[model samples]
Target: MNTMFDSSNPASAPRVWEVGALCHAIGDALQARFNPVAVRGEISGFSRAASGHCYFNLKDAGGQIRCAMFRRNAEQMGFYPRDGELVEVRGRLGVYEQRGDLQLVVEQLQRAGQGAWFEQFLRLKAKLEAEGLFDTARKRPLSTMPRGIGVVTSLGAAALHDVVTALRRRVPHIPVVIVPALVQGAQAPQSLVDALQKMYLLAQSGQGQEADLAQKSPLIDCILLVRGGGSMEDLWAFNDEQLARTVVQSPVPLISGVGHETDFTIADFCADLRAPTPTAAAELVAQPRELWLGALDLLQDRLESAVQRVLDRSAQRLDLAAQRLGRPSEQLSRNHLQLARQAQRLRHAMLFKLQRMTQNQQALQAQLPQSLQRRLEQQKQGLERMDLRLQLLDPRLVLQRGYALLTDTKGKPVTQIKQAPPGAALKAQLADGAVDVVVTQPRLL
Candidate 1:
């Protein structure tokens, strides 16, 4: 405390000063006196500006002091503050010259007496991280354009409304299903688990009966877990270990938008994608209709070019084949000439063979007649010779030459006559005549 002029000491007339000078001096004094203080109070009038600066009042049962947290400082604090939260703020105590108000330029803040929740959060986080649950390698990738999307949030939540509006505007044809659940309160975590299971079933089954969609044709491609911004206590349901594990094990990809951009929870790390807001999540899952149409047009142009090139190639091939083919009429004329030559040779060979066979038949006919004439002459000569020999041996000729013959009455010729048997009749024969006689005696002569 500067004791330059003590009004209690009755100093000769107190030092007169302008209001601006007085305020400046007080500010300077306050800045120099107290620094790096820890003020325990309940938060009130808490609000964050667009510049990321935080403004609030710290109060107890008796009085309150104004506070300001700059964008740079509050950013490092890692959590947003809400009204009526008991907190201990660390800052430099000072006075604002313009408003003549005492204030605290906050550097950091801690939630008063709720260290156990933070500790539990850290423990579960450590366990999951050790198990590689938050590994980027293990995370699933969201489809570029989901067929259908499922959402798990309170039906009355403003987050749901924002998400629907964004999705419908982007892709009016894409289907969106709401898996309603309590997003806060004691039953919130289990509700989240059941809702996620139902969503996964809906995705795998490709059925809209349980997912509550109009058509059952398209499958659910991704799930969104979203809620509006709230204090850490209000958002604690998302920090449940079971819920985080369920998100990690989801059948389809999951996006977490639980709370504002500055707020985060265990669910955010476990999800396949983390969106800053529900509207952002919806945008990530859908593609604009105009963009899709433009892409299709480009592909159509490429296809037409390829087909034309193929057709040109085919026409060129057909022309080459036509050039390679020869005239069929010329080929047939050559074949006809060769066939005529072969037929002439065949006719000459037949005539020559027939003439040779005729000459051989005439020679055989001439030999047959001569052979028959020679055989007839040989037979006639043999007959004439035999006749001559028969004439020489004739007995009539011998009789004419004085030869005589005798015969018995029996008409047998007898070279020796024993004189006929006594009383037997006999005949004596001359060459020309014969006489009969009777024998009186037998004699050998």
Candidate 2:
């Protein structure tokens, strides 16, 4: 490094300056003139390094300047910065010694109209809060097991892929219904409302009696409204008051997963649940299939144990009954002894009655012969008296006493003299014989 000087008028001669010293001199002048400056420009060629330092160019029609924002300052930014976005930065102007270039070291960076947007956001938030849309009591708990899931997002968004992938992995059996809509433009709020209303129609169809409507629409138990990370201006659609009101009208629980963890929107406050990311929203509605299967197995085991216990108790009761009952053979032997004693008493009574009847018949037989002999003697004496009376009146006895029996020739006895007439022949019956006779004279005497 040679130092050169002009020799004309030594005090006023130009001093020789080294390259490093000249660079230092320029840096000092910049620091004193505009050390802290605020510049508004469009960002260009912005990139973050591995060390968390951000490097970019801020440009306008007048000129462009190199800028650097360290990690500490970048973290404090409310929104992500991108190329072509108009932003205002407050920093110190300095010269880089190594490259001899002018640079700005940014201490803070914000969107060009961030203050106005922030005021609007705050006003909307306060209005909705007063209406109780953000109240915890208004928020419903998500279904533990959803029959079907409805998704509302752009068809081409990365958020759709993340949400669908998570749901399929956890609950492949459950069907998913996607209603695509714009999620970032001016029309995004109304598009989201229409998509949600379609899903609401499907949910109502399942509960109604309209079989046609139910058949045409797939039932959804819950809805997920999701979008990827973006700048505050890019995500302003979700902050719309109309979109927030539509979120509250969901028939089933609705989950809002609209940005990165650091982002917030009005829809998130009105929704039933809020998730930090799209994938997290899907996981909240789906439970793992293996977990449910484990619960079923536990219930089956409990039922089998209950049935086995009942059978064991029945067997114990049967054993106790058998112990209390005596043997059948002992009961039969006691009945047989009582029957034998009754038969013996009946046989002895029959023998005594037969003996008394036989003795009475023998006494009657001994008296019968004496009664017959007395009756025969009395009958013979009566017969003798009748015979004596008959002998006293006999006709032969009168003849033997010298009385004749006179009879006529015809053998008729003449009892009167008048019966014998003159010239009449007569027969006389003496005691020995009969004599014939004729009557000469008759007398009355």
Candidate 3:
């Protein structure tokens, strides 16, 4: 590199400088002449490098200027820098030596219409980010079922009403402790810090108004630092760097709901949780009551149905079990059939014996008269024979024929009539008739 300059001789040629030297001199002059500045322009060709550097062009109706935001300064940005968004950038004027291009090394950024105040907010955000206070690792997760919640905001702010209303609608039983504070104005920062401290003490002791409000409300599980929507200046109190640090170090997790969804603040970056609004934060902490009750009813119905099914199955089993036994009527019918068979056999045996006895009696009766007549006839014949023999011996034949029987006067037949009285009348005997002698006639001997 060489420089051409007029020598001390009069009428020397014009000065010339080497290309690098000239660029360096120009860059030095530009840096010294212009200092920290704010430029309003629309972003164009905005892109972030892999190394976390933002490269873009800030263009206006007239012209455009190149800009670069390094990783450190870019981390402080609350929203992505998109192309065509009007923005305000504050930084020093500089030149890229390698390219010899004029560019802005932006250290602060904000939406358009924000002037000095925006720059201050960015600087503070950058400072806190640099200190790692806004690190995601430092943020604690919100409790799933926090026993109690602490609120830090103005008592008169709409944000408080929104939060409390949402909480009551969702989980009315959960304890909420409010530590009132000024949400805006100069005193808001210290007031917020004091409210946070009071909630912390309430969590630790629960011996005062907080205890009375919620007798069972225990240690503060989380805190909500909220405020209604407002202008950047109105919400400036939340951007206090000290407040951000306090939120980061809170004993309980903190949720920041400082403004509308598009708005962001130091509190939002440093808090454990960030909600677009106070109501959203409340919804996040607890679920709606109706949802739980509906689930319980469904479970109860299922349980009852299951029990009924079991009972029906058991009753069916019992019916099947009872059917296994034979029917009583059938059993009795079988018993009766057996008894009838036994009775028939008994009746037949009795009839057979009675018939046999009746036959024997009839046979005896039929033979009795014949037997008696035979015996009586035999005796009568024997007597007739004897009578005939006697008649024959005594010439009874002549007597029976002539029918005469003579006897001595003594009625002695015969051989000896001596002893008979002569005066006695004689007796005659015949086979059919006999005449008796009147006298006591002695029979002839």
Tens-digit lDDT string for candidate 1 (147-265): 78899999999999999999889999888778899999999999999989888888888865743445564688899999988877889999999999899888888999988997878
For model 1, what is the error of residue 309's alpha carbon versus the real structure, in angstroms, after optimal superposition? 1.2
Candidate 3 Cα errors over 4 Å, as ranges:
1-116, 211-219, 298-445
Better of 2 and 3 by TM-score: 2
Q: What is the C-alpha local distance difference test score of candidate 1? A: 0.76
Better of 1 and 3 by lDDT: 1
Error of 1 at 387 (Å): 99
Give model 3 RMSD, 1 decimal. Answer: 41.2
Per-candidate RMSD, Å? 41.3, 44.7, 41.2
Error of 2 at 414 (Å): 99
Candidate 1 or 2, higher TM-score? 1
Estimate, for each residue in 1-445, the C-alpha lDDT of model 2 and write its tens digit.
8766647668868778998899899889999999789999999999989998999999999999999999998876656678998999999999888998899999988888786786688789899999999999978888887888889999999999999899889999898878789998888889988988877887777542233344344578899999998878778999899888888999999999989987888899899999998999989998987776566556445533543453344334434433443322223235334433432343344335324533653533343344333543443343334334433334455667887777666656578877888888887666676677788988775
What's the candidate order when arranged by decreasing TM-score?
1, 2, 3
Instruction: Give the lowest summed-lDDT range of ten residues in model 3.
Output: 321-330
Best candidate according to TM-score: 1
**Which regions of candidate 1 are displaced past 4 Å?**
1-37, 41-76, 81-87, 91-108, 111-116, 211-217, 323-445
Q: On residues 12-117, what C-alpha lDDT tens digit does candidate 3 reach at each position?
A: 7656688788888888898788977678899999999999999999999999999999999999776677689899998988778789899999998777876678
